[model samples]
Target: MFVQEIAPLAGSLGLSALVAVLPLATVLVLLGVVRMKAHHAALLGLLVALVVAIAVYGMPIGQAISSGFQGAAFGLFPIMWIVVNALWIYRITVRTGHFDVLRRSFGKVSDDPRMQALLIAFCFGALMEALAGFGAPVAISSVMLVALGFTPVRAAVVSLVANTAPVAFGAMGTPVVTLAQVSGIPLNTVSAIVGRQTPILAVFVPLLLVIIVDGRRGVRETWQPALVCGLTFGVVQFAASNFVSAQLADIGAALAGAAALVLMPATRKPAREEVRAAVLTGVATEQLERPEDRGEVLRAYLPYLLIIVIFSIGQIPPVKKLLDAATWNFHWPGLHVAGSSGKPVSGNTFSLPFLNTGGTLVLIAGILTVLALHVSARDAVREWGATIHELRFAILTVAGVLALAYVMNLSGQTTTIGYLIAGAGAGLAFLSPLLGWFGVAVSGSDTSANALFGALQVTAAHQAGLSAELLASSNSSGGVLGKMISPQNLSIACAAAMLPGEEGTLLRKVLPWSLGLLLLMCLIVVGQSTILSGMLP
Candidate 1:
């Protein structure tokens, strides 16, 4: 048994920690500094992780190979599975001309491009994330943004930024659920705590969106719309996560925001012509031209409706049981190294078959969408092939990032880095969100981030005399902010936008805003711990 010693540089803890961080640094340098393509950068990062895991961590060759394969397999199944299906759904709509009708329907609500971005990319995407996650929001929203007349770069940027706020509670509350499991906190407490922190930011996200899209004067002009949108989203997100199932939080908030746009006059603001003129340079006005078929528009939207229904049915007891019955779970052997006391150091590994996963649900929706659109089988197959071609690079990027994440976690280097923060005692509260931010930045999913650090946060909270639930929830909430700039998500957004080779520019644009919001989340968590005890669960 190799018990880790927590010295600065003379121990396995210190060495492992440095080894873990090297790959991440390689990612930043390769992508941000060298301006390499995302796929190439990701591959380089994965190589670094593999090398460090073998040489520094002293992990057996077979165990290391097994870990990488496991990570890559899991990445492809659920994560890539969701992306492909969601993108396929979008492709079907475009190929069948139904997306034109949906675009027109949105325009009928409000001709303002800014408002459309808010409604579809932010609000509607949140709903999709709540329903299917695993890259669904980024997949759906980025394409919508592009179709709405934004340049691919701008569309990618907008969708990535907008997707951030709802991520922690996305996909039937997976992130919070993972947090609960890892921290050993009651699920209700984690939900309430995350709810308390998320909605505070939700209140300000619309204002932030306006600022990002159209600067201060533009935000001033759209104040009423921003207020209505933000409040509706924030209020429902706050209420549903705390009072109802956390799984329903983002979906409820999104529906409420969409409702505000549909029913509330003040929520649909007409962007001033002058502001539109300034930002619409080099853009063909044809892209923003509204469609004329309202009935057809509703019909065009059946796929998304079916997505919600299918996802909801899959969550039901009997349906879920049948699905679970079909899933194949396999335990990984030979990777568990026993401790001195004879307990295994590594946890059990299991694989749930793809057909039973959230990704498969999205895939089924894509197929149903194709059928509803009445496309011929040949055309449908063509659409699927084209969709795969479009997203191939992104699939590679997601796989690489997930592999890097697994290497970090298994190497004990992440723990070494966490222990550095945990050593800060009371100061750990301020750093908690940052740790989670780093986690999601690497992993691109809050569920993975929470699983990586939730227990660590609990331990740090106990040592620091802080609230364990609050800290754990804070980690999840903070993870949302990091989602905006995650390389995996950025890659997905760029792919959906058809904006290849510009991932770095998008990252630079969104990084400041993401970091600033993360700081605010940190403050909110600290305050919840010290000032507003009753406010926390």
Candidate 2:
């Protein structure tokens, strides 16, 4: 088998690293600057990666092609699978006329746009992220905000920003689990470090959400509730991740935050007369027409309740083992090459874990939703087909991006780039989380980002005399910010908002927030590495 080369361009690491970054740069410029569609940008990025791997990196064309196919297949199976099914479930709810009841129920909670954003976009969105992730929170919450009368752009932006805090522990803590596996760190230790870092952000994310939703006025009117929500979520997340169970940390935190919101008394002073009149008129219309019924409310929430139950069942060890027993695992053909580290590169394989995967659980939840709602199988099938049709572009974007990631990784281009960044030495602590931000910005999955950079972060931390756990955890915490700008996520937000060609606008809206939060995470990580070294568990 052919071994990989980290510095393939005249043995110059910097030049090799620049060549390695061509694919990522191509995507970013095409999407963010040139305003290309996400799928088109991803395709162009994939082509650039292929050229770099074959020509500059000297990877055999056959192996590069095989690796790309492998990554694309993975993107379709679990990633797209989850998104499509989650949207389909939502469609079923809307079709059964239950979503209206759900919206009205939320209106009953608080009709203020700012409060709605906090309750739905931030609090409920975190719960979705904790369980499903992979665009589920954005897709579901953005649509909910739109139904609640937010402008499409505002809804998309709020959902994207709100998605940040829970992301590190998202999809049943998959990102942290991947970090531990790749970095050779204990799961609990990595989880604890991440817990310490992200909870700080979590405590302020609701405030950020309110500000984004209604600017300074939003924060002014809602600071008490926002603080209550954030503090509750952050504290529970910290406790659960460090003291209880990392896997269930976000679940506990989300529940606590939601409970806190439900229990807290609304104390906002009355709006100005006209504004209060408009708000009351709207709430009166909704309540008069929809009239929330307890059963309908339960049914409105049943799909998500089923989702929690199904996912929890799938996580049970014995049940997980039984389900995963049927998983398929195999090396990709024609890609059995090794990396510069003497480890197999393209030949690395993972179990498909079809039955136990989060996507499959979501799919099962959708099926059960149909049964519970008593919808005809024909209608359910139609909605599923419609969900797929709507996500065609998203599928292409995600698949192409994953293919590019795999090609760069297998050809050793990623290693060259990573090593170049790691060369920052002691200063690398400040830049460590940015590495994860870059990875997630490209791959569109925090789990994938952790898989890409977790080991690299550990290696760099050793060289720089930094805390490996802290830096590795920073990779995940920082990646949460990158999700807002990820092309795949942008596509999901756009589609959910029914503004397919407005991705650039959405990216522009969320980019500053993403960068600002990433910078904060960098400061936190740098502190943990030096002055706050005592914080490491």
| Each candidate structure's count of clashing pairs | 1, 0
Alpha carbon deviation, residue 143, candidate 1 (Å): 6.7
What is the alpha-carbon lDDT of model 1 when measured against the actual structure?
Answer: 0.72
lDDT of 1 by residue, 30-99 (tens): 7656868767877888788778767776666776666666656655766566657666777788888887
- Best of the candidates, lDDT: 2
Q: TM-score of each candidate?
A: 0.81, 0.85
Best by TM-score: 2
Give the Å shift of residue 247 in candidate 2. 6.5
Output the lDDT of residue 313, model 1. Answer: 76
RMSD (Cα, Å) of model 2: 3.9
- Assess candidate 2 and give its lDDT: 0.80
